[model samples]
Target: MEYRISEPFTKEKFAQLKAGDTVLLTGTVYTARDAAHKRMVEMLQEGGQLPFEIKNSVIYYVGPTPEKPGNPIGSAGPTTSYRMDAYAPVLLDLGETGMIGKGQRSQTVKEAVLRNGAVYFAAIGGAGALMAQRVESAEVIAFEDLGAEAVRKLSVKDFPVTVILDSKGGDLYSEGRAAYLESRE
Candidate 1:
């Protein structure tokens, strides 16, 4: 089922979602790819405060292209999730509740999701132009030196995503692949 959800993802909000559910996420999302993630993790290791609040937040794994005139963002497609897997668990443990990315995650990230009552979301690949339309505003909040890979705070409206992994350990990728194999038999 398709669900329309906003930010400040509470326990109740997360509990209602499951793997394979469609989500139209509207609200504040922090943009971070592997570089930003690594920095955040390093900060955490050093007991430094994160640039933004991690608790009850969603992080989109994207490094957007240059914006055209008057647009909040450019082609903002999701990066491969595995690149951030190394740092995800640490952030999740620190209260990050949701993620938006593409491709499979490591077993560690999957375990962290369940352990932290978090959800992993997958945005469509090659749909960057369409995805940028949902972003109402975007600002660089941290890591500006990284250029396109810089961390951004984005205010989005009806940003599309799918629940690839859920708080209860359900995995859409695994289920979908298994179903596909079964159908071929």
Candidate 2:
């Protein structure tokens, strides 16, 4: 089924998600990559304030290319999710409720999602141009020196994503594979 989720996801909103569901996200989402995640975790370790509030927020693991003229953003597609696994549990513990990226997540991240009632959504990789079209506007919010790796606040409309992992521990990857194999038997 299709779901349209708003930003700053609430418990009620997250509870409705299940693995394998399609979602159209409309609202604000923050961008971050490896360097940004490291900095944020370092700040946390030193008892510092995060650049933005993590509570009920969604973070997209992407580092878009330089925008061409007349575009709000460049090729904005999802990065590999495993790159952020080392830092995900901390963010989840800090109240981050959703993640948008491509590829799989670590078991630790999966556990964190279940414990914190968070969800993981996958955007199609290699669809950068198509994804960028959904981004109405974007501005760097922090770590400007990191260039494309900087954190940016993005306003998106009808951004496509698939629920790979739900708050209840449902995982579409394993389930889908199992079903496919079963069908051939």
Model 2 is weakest, by summed lDDT over 10 consecutive residues, at: 5-14
Give the alpha carbon lDDT tens digit for every residue of 1-185 in model 1: 89999877765698789899999988999999989999998998898999999889899999999898988889998999999999999989988999999999999999999998999999999999999989999999999999999999999999999999999989999998898999999
lDDT, candidate 2, residue 127?
96
Q: For candidate 1, what's the RMSD?
A: 1.0
Stretches off by above 4 angstroms in model 1 are none
Query: lDDT tens string, model 2, 1-185?
Result: 89988766776698899999999998889999999999999999999999998898899999999988889999999999999999999999999989999888889999999999899999999999999999999999999999999999999999999999998999998988998999999
Model 1 TM-score? Answer: 0.96
Clashing pairs in 1: none
